[model samples]
Target: MRNGGCCPKLDPLPGEEESAVRTSHWRKELERRRDSVERETDGSNMKTATRKKDGEKEVRAMAPLAPQLCSRLAQKAMMRSSVTKSMASRDRVRFNVGGQLFETTSTTLANAGRDSMLGALLDDSWNPGQPEYFLDRNPACFSVLLDLLRTGALHIPANVPQKLLYREALYYGLLDHVRNAKWGPFDGNRLRLADSVPGRAPGDGTAIRAAPDGGCCVAHGSVVHVYNWMLEERRPISLDYQQVNDVGYIDADSIVITARERLGRAEGGMAVFSAATGELQHRFRVEHGQQPKSFTAGALSLAGPDDNRIFSSCKGRLNEYGIGMWDLNTGQQGDFFYELPGCSLGDADILQWLPSKNCLMVATLFPRTDNCFIGLLDFRAKTIPWSWSDAGIVVTLEDKRVLHAIAMEDGHSICVINQYEDLGFIDLRAGTGTNSAGTGVRWSSRSKLMNRKVPFEESCYPKLATHNGQLFSCMNDSISVFSGSEHVLTSTLSRSYGGSICDFSIGGDRLFALHNEDNVFDVWETSPSPII
Candidate 1:
């Protein structure tokens, strides 16, 4: 076209000949610009150089620019840098973990939420340093935690102990991670079932009594089996009765028992047995001058080691309901050994004996009401010096709360268990004798909602037992130990061999557990460890 002549007649070379020159010239220009940009952005102060076509090095001085032009260029460069940083923050996060570098996507960590340590560190609202996070933790353990965050699963190495891994997971609030990894109880490693012994009878284990002579007495049906420390069968005493309420050792070989008549053939009474000879030493009728009484529904507790007297709760005509006494040698029963002062206690039972204080701790249920009472018998005064009723515990806690109680080592305080599986202490030393409005004694709650894994209605009544100044509570299949001084829970033994516990006792430096399985019992002792 003639237009090219007017513009000075530039002509295209034929085919590849023209393309070759154009490509070579443009490649040189691109290389020059690239080298200049690299020099500006490389963050180095040294002057750069270029090579000429003759292969000789040519020094290039970066020319100083006008102040306004340089300022505009700097602003554009800063905007680009900020945009790059924003994109990186949205896509991923970087961490300097214990000097070890790590990176992951933002969404991966957000799944655990900001409450977790990792999420808190990555939170943009509070943390302006989004590109890099630093954590002072074991890199090896941190790697495991990060993997859990990314994959929603914890894959711990074989060399890492689970306990150590658990500790790290807890620190990161990743306990739920491990919990989701495992099912059932999380305390399998904390407690162990040491030993279990089969029950000696058919109907669930009723009671386990540890004798003073290192022997254990297990009661079922009408017989009590005594076992030496080695689980060897000592003489088994078979009582001539239908039901045996309770049994305890009066001496190394002699034991006392409370029972009822089988079909009303014989008088239901308290009897003594000789473990060494399997002989019926004596039997005292649980009656008041020919008025047949029943002790089968009640409990028994020894008066004193040498007093040769035992206390029992006897049921008879409404007028004869009271606590009875038995003289081991005289074979005599006291009708009104100690009755409720003004009114007849609906139902009373001796729960424990405080030899040091010469007092008997008793539990009574008020008639026609859900109210219950815990009384302390001052043997010297022959009356109840202090008593606590359900109304007195807590007005809001008036729903048959207390089921059983045990005198603490102090003798002035009693540890009680409620129907709700809660443990509390009642101070008997502060109460006035009358306590008309249920304000005589004071109750302080401790270890509430224990046995949370098993509800009270689904399990047997939790039992309380104390030994060596330590308060032990048999809740469900486990035993909770509390410091007698502060009433704070110190330890929990939740391992049950196989069945639900019906009763338990602590004595003879051993813990005896009676499960619902017929004739099944377990023994536990603290394994020695360094005091420090």
Candidate 2:
């Protein structure tokens, strides 16, 4: 009758005597054979005939089985949340104190061996006798509430009784859900964590950049959270929710995003989400404890005709494992691409995909062996041989002819890449690269400090992009355009992105979008006549 390691909200731990008494309650479980034999022969009677025997052999009889012992052990392992149903009156009733709405009945399923502290609010007052939906029978409410607490959003069936009450479905994952099924326009904005004076998001007016097509993405949390920047009526509309570590535009409407979520108890790691709706379209979760900390998801290159045949880079734990393929259509491994005998992907490994040629480029990070190298893999080939990187941060110019890579002294660094507006001369077919060591295409930041020591351009790694033949990059609160090196600063200004920017996409029209990798982003465009 002691707490016996029960939930914190329940009875406390037992006294010394109770603890010691329970500790000695171990009993060897009935082996499968013995249990089977007992099932086959219930009574102690065994028939004996012939052999001059009076004929009756007694088998070992089962003792009066302690019923309370099995129940107690089961109680120790089973957990209860705020929503547990008790059979009140003749009808069975379910309870959910978390929602604060007693219903006719409900059923939830929680995972085993985990604790649900926030769900401890349910009690016995829930009753079904009055026709009020008090308690049904659900064990999963704990996980639902835990998810809400963690991500500030919860995905539930729309028909649930309390679904209407959820004007705000908050869950973890750095994204917010503003449910306005009522008549009103609702847009998903990135959740900003910096200073927000009450409901006013940080530099929201200054932040909030639109993508190339002219629409904005919701930004939130320590990391970047962009709803799939798909468009509607030339406006940015979220297709789904996606939390990605990094992203690259594969084509006009599709961009590959790397996403990961970490839940306690060995369930965590990276996945790939879609850029259209911000939804986790596909993911291969590597068990946190099962694999090495440095195991790669084989992102060195992604190629396919927009189907599910995806490949991953993995380590077998000892040395270089090999290249593995994933059949996205079925989420299974389709093929083993190749193997690097002693090579492996390090922390800053870079993977690039060139769709036109159906090839992939990979850069491996090893301390003293080789610099960044590029490799090409063909889905049609029998072997996937890796070509080392001459440099990291490889990118294509607007003209689609030239490729650019950042060159430094050491070999492990990957400078951020961004597309600056077409500010260079229209006379030149592509933009240019200028850094500390000219252009080695095989260098890194050996002794440079990222913040206080690295050069402005070296650390910032400015991108070059063109819109309407005008080259532009967001610099110091103004979108600066360049004609050759001659610059023209847009007098119109947006709020400052604290750090140098790296990523942006055309949200809609002339509305340019910009983000500082870690902070909230802002959208800017020249204004027409002030509309009423």
Badly placed stretches (over 4 Å) of model 2 are 1-224, 227-244, 247-266, 269-282, 285-327, 336-349, 364-370, 382-497, 506-518, 524-532
Compose the digit string of candidate 1's lDDT tens values, residues 1-532: 5665586666666687778989999999999999999978664433232224223322222234456678999999999999998777666778888899998877778876778876775555745445687878777887888887776655678987666776777788876665454322212123345467786577766678876544588988888888865566777877754578778878777778777645545456677888766688887676566765554435787776667777777665445566676677777875355465553342564367787667777775433235667777765567776677755444554453666778887777777776556776666666544356264334444434332433534566778877667777776677777774776677877553556677887655567788774458876654322225
Per-model TM-score versus the true fold: 0.56, 0.35
Report, for all candidates in order, the number of backbone clashes. 5, 88
Kindly report which residue pairs in candidate 1 clash with one another: 198-519, 199-519, 199-520, 200-519, 431-440
Consecutive 10-residue window with the lowest summed lDDT within model 1: 182-191
lDDT of 2 at 122: 29
The models' CA-based lDDT, in order, is 0.67, 0.36
lDDT of 2 by residue, 333-370 (tens): 55544454433432224454445445544445423223
Find the candidate with the highest TM-score and give its number.
1
